[model samples]
Target chain A: MHESASTQTNPSPRVQRAPQQPKTADAYVVTPAIDVYEGAEELRVFVDLPGVAADGLDLDLDKEVLTLTANRAARGRDRAVTYKRRFALPREVAAENVSAKLEDGVLLLTLPKRAALRPRSIKVTSG
Target chain B: MWSLLHNDTMKLFDAFERQFQDSLAVRRADTAISFLDNGDELVISADVPGMKQSEIEIMIEGEFVTLRAERKPGAFEGFKLSRAERGAQKLVRQIELPCRIDAEAVRAELKDGVLTVHLPKAEGAKPRRIPVKASA
Candidate 1:
């Protein structure tokens, strides 16, 4: 007889907090795919939002909730659509130091960690 | 006889493996596209996010258009990937138009990771209005 076993990891508590969305039935809403990267100093997020211009992008951070909203214009037979997403920050970050840029329909966001949370090298003094 | 049976069984498994891979390729190549007619011209829009203009290839022949694109992994320096829903992929899609197209006048433009192809209708494919004449 052969025995097989598998274990499932529990979902993070922070990830359980679903994004708050209001009723919007006019235009189609899509949640763009995103990739999150973690570094010693900051966290980087890459969002795939094709057909969105810079003027149609909006980013806001209130408390620990970061929201991203992008509007795509109607083209040919394709109707206008809105891409909206929200994420709860896992760690403290410097709100004022966050930076974002869009290139080739990909949005890159950098969130710097708070000074107290950032890892620093300790210098050793010889006695 | 035993060796011959083994060979036949291996060949059957090889054929099944190839069929399974082909179906997976078809599913992965499903790119979103929209085709529309704009008076004397036709337009095609495809969503190809995170792909550069140079990474996409377009070929048009007669009434058929094919798009090939490759998206590389979005890797960051000095950073570790935490979550990745989108990964490197290769897309190939071929479309057949309803009517003939003017190959010489075909134009394509890529903006914001979307490829738009404008194809003009050929002379023979365009609709013509016939003038009514009263018999004297």
Candidate 2:
């Protein structure tokens, strides 16, 4: 039977989690909703990953694919969730300038664009 | 049908869930919750990712409990949203507890996007200890 419309809304979301959780098989995966912004200097991604702490967060960028995993401590609840998601970046990223910040369960990723990809105004010099 | 199966075949239902984990991807939203009774109090815990504590409101009336919150949009002007699963969500929850709780004894905490509420059991609803003495 289907639950009521209100109850049917999916409520669980997480990233990478402890291996021991979901003992019978793979850890439960929750897909958090995200918002990606294309800025002049950087591409920013904001993800809502409640219940995940700083230590439980894992982020990796390989080639052009960015992968994020977060573990939310269930606190003795039934499921200790591990949320995972991957984003294929459209443009090259500046290797050293990429940054990340998390607060109040919201993860903010600042992906700086490569020198060539960033838009720059070229001055016209008349000789 | 819901009540019958949930009350009588809980173990079987749980087994079904366990069996499906390996083969399928389960989507969990922020509305999921757990209700527990430890005899002294009724504890409720839920997941509400990306929401700050300031955005949440809790209301208790008699045997009912309600949770309300709004998630602020993080995007700004001139920013294009490439992908979004939970773009911007609002939560409204109302449920009834089997046992009455003390309104003054309620306590709550929101951390790491998880919200936990503790409602102390009403004095009259608590089970009383029985005193047994040697028969004279």
Indicate which candidate wins on TM-score. Answer: 1
| For model 2 chain B, the run of ten residues with the poorest summed lDDT | B5-14
lDDT (CA) per prediction: 0.73, 0.71
> Taking the tens digit of each residue's C-alpha lDDT, what string does model 1 give over B6-55?
34433553354344332122212125688898869888888887788889
Provide per-model DockQ scores: 0.22, 0.23
* Residue ranges of candidate 2 with Cα displaced over 4 Å: A1-26, B1-28, B129-136
Provide i-RMS per model in Å: 13.3, 12.5
Candidate with maximal DockQ = 2
The alpha-carbon root-mean-square deviation between model 2 and the true structure, to one decimal in Å, is 14.4
> Candidate 2's residue-wise lDDT over B12-47, tens digit each?
423443443421443546667788887888888877
Ten contiguous residues with the weakest lDDT in model 1 chain B: B21-30
Tens digit per residue, CA lDDT, model 1, A75-122? 766777777777665445677788999988889989887878656678
